[model samples]
Target: MLYDAIRFQAFHQDMRIAMIGVKGVPAAMTTGGGIERHVEQLAPRLAGLGHEVTVYVRHYANPRGTKRWNGCTLVTLPTIRRKYLEAIVHVFLSTLHALRQKYDIIHYHGVGPSTLSWIPRVFAPRCRVVITFHSRDQFHEKWNIIARAYLAWGEWTAVRFPHATIAVSHVIQQFCIKLFGVKPFFIPNGVEIPSASIGSDRMKTLGLEPGRYFLGLGRLIPHKAFDDAIRAFRNVPTAMSLAIAGAPGYDMRYAEELYALAELDPRVRLLGFRTGEDLQQLLAHCYAYVCPSRSEGLSIAVLEAMSHGKVVLMSNIPENLELIDHSGMSYEVGNIQDLTRLFTFAAREPALLRERGERARHIVKLHFSWDSIVRQTDSVYESLKA
Candidate 1:
C-alpha cells in the first residue's frame, strides 16, 4: 500500500516518489548538462521534504550500479546499447522494474522514450503520473523528416498518458497545445548565482586579453546556430575574438564544418568542453555572451550567462525574448544581417554592454532563482498527493 502522509500523518508519513527517465538523479548528479542538473538539484530537494525518492536511470555506460545520494536512491536497469536505440530499451525495462516497486507518484522526463509512459498507464494506473517536456525535439534541424515524425508521435503518446504535464517554457507549453493538444503547466528552468571566484581567471589561462572576445557556450549542435554567431563576429570592426565552448556530441560532420570555418578565421576559437571553474572563468571575462539558437525552450546557457552578469545577444525566439527585452539586447534568429548589426552595435558602445549585463543579472535574480523554482516543484509534488 502507498503511504498517505497527509491522510495518515502519524502512521504513514513518508511518500514514495519515483523519477523516471533515460538518465536521472545520481547519474546526472555529477556530469551531464542541463537536464542532468535539473535532476541533480530537484531530487535532493524532494528527498529533503521527507519523501522517499528513487531515480530510475538507463544502464548505459554507468558502472556504479545502485547508489544513494542526497537521501535519494538511484536504480539503474540494463539496456541494449548506449546509443539512442538503447533509450527505448531502457524505458521498457525501467518501467517494468518500477511497476514491481511500490511508488505513489511517477515523474517522467522527455518524450523520446515513450515506452516509459505507455507502461505506467497500463501497469501503474493508480500512481499519479507526471511528465515534463524539456524541449520539443522536433525543432532540431539534425533530425531527418522520418525521425521528426517518429519523435512527434512519441511526444503525442507521452503527453496523452500523463495525468498532468510540465512545459519548461511558455513557448514549449504552446507547442504542446498545438502539437499534442495538451495544456502543460509551465515551469521555467532556474539558476543559482555562482560564487565570485568561479570563473575569475579563465581569460588569463586561455591566453585571451581582457575585453577582446565574446563567448558562445552550449552543445555543439547545428540547431544552436554557432555558424551564425561566427558570421556575425566577422562584421565587428574591432579585432574581437569569439570563443565557442561545448561538447560536440550529436553531429561530428557539423562540428567538422564549424572547425573548418574557425580554421579560416583566426578570430574564432573552439574550446570543445569546459567544466567547473574553467567555464565560469570564460563567462566572467567575456565582453559579451551570444546565443544564436534557431529554437530553444528557455536556454540554461543563456540563463548561466545572465547569472554571470554578461550582456547576451540571443536569437529572436520566444524562449529568449521572454527573458531579455532590453535596449542593448536585440534579436536575430535567421537573419545574418541583423546578427551582424547587433554585434557591430555592441562593439561600438561598450557602456551599453555593461548596462545590459547588469540588467540581465537583475532580471534573472528576480525570476529565475533556484529557490523559487524548487518551491514551485514542491507544490507540484504536493498537488499529486492532494
Candidate 2:
C-alpha cells in the first residue's frame, strides 16, 4: 500500500510473438525439413530473448488442441487436409486463430496459403505481419499448368499483403522482386557446425562401411535429380558407393524410377529417411556430399553437410553458387557429364576431397551458424516492434 501510494510507472518490454505456419514444434522436429527446421530453431530462440512466442500450426496429426515445449506454446487449429492444396485452408484457419490471440507480431512462412495473410488486415490491423517467403515453389517443372497459376497467384498475395517480407536467399529475393514486385530482406538458413568425430561406428549400424560411400541427402523429389547423381556415379571409381538418404513423399513415382534405374547396380543404395545420429554419422564419414538439385533456396541438407566438414558436389544453381562457387568445387545443373567428371576427380584425388571439405567447414562457420542467424532474426523482430 505504501509503494502504490508513492508512484506509478509504465514498463516497456519485449513484444509477444506468433509464428504461423502449417507445422507445429514436435511434428516439425520429428519430420525434418527446411521450414520445420527454421521454426524449430527460431521460435525457441526468440522465446529465450524474453519474447512471448506462440506458434500456430495446422491441425493434422495433433489430437491435442494446444501443447507446450521448450518454453514455446503451440496452438493447433482445425482444417481440411485432403490434398497439398488444402494447406491453404489449414493456414487460413490457423491465421484466424492467431489473430484472436494477443500477439504483437505475426510471422508467416511460405506462399502457398494466400488467404492466410488477410487475417492480419481483417482481424488484427494493429499487429505487425511479417512473412518469410521460403521459396518460389512453382518454378519446378513438377507442377501442372493450373497448379502453377494458382501458386503464382498465391505468391503475389503473400508478397503484397505482408507488412514486411523475408527471402531466405539472394536468389529468392531477386525472384520475388522480379515476379511479384516485392523487395524482401534476405535471411539465409542456419546450421550447427559439428565437432570432429569418426562416424564409422554409426555408419556400421546402418550397414555401411567407413570411408566407402558418398552421400546424397534430401527428399526423393523429381527436381532433386537423384537419378543424375546415380548416372554421374557410374563414372566414379569402383570402390566408392553412393548412398541416397531421404524419404519418398511427394515423388513416389520418382522414387520408383530411381529404384528401377539402379536395379542391378549395387553401387547405388537408396537409404530412405535417416535422422539424428544416423544422418550425422553419414555426413561425418562420407567421401563427399552431393546435391544434384536443379533448383533450390539455400538447401538445409547442403548446409548440414558443410557443417560436418564434408566436401559438397552441388548443381550450379544460384543458391548453390551463393554457398559454394565453381573455383574449388561445383558442377553444372542437370549435366551428368560434368557431375561424372567431378565424381571421378573426387575419387581419384582423395586429398583434394579433404581440402575442399575443410574449406566447406570454414564457409559454414563464417556464414551459417545458428547463433548468428538467430541474432539476425531477432534484429528483424526488433525492427517490426519499433
Deviation from native of the Cα of residue 180 in model 2, angstroms: 4.5
RMSD of each: 4.2, 5.2
Candidate 1 structure quality by residue, lDDT tens digits, 25-63: 542222355676677777887788678988877665356
Give TM per candidate. 0.89, 0.90
Candidate topping TM-score: 2
- How well does candidate 2 match the true structure in TM-score terms? 0.90
Against the unseen true structure, what C-alpha lDDT does each candidate score? 0.77, 0.77
C-alpha-based local distance difference test score of model 2: 0.77
Residue by residue across 308-384, what tens digits does model 2's lDDT show?
Answer: 77788888888888887432368889999999998888888788778777788888888877877876776677777
**Where does the lowest 10-residue lDDT sum fall in candidate 1?**
22-31
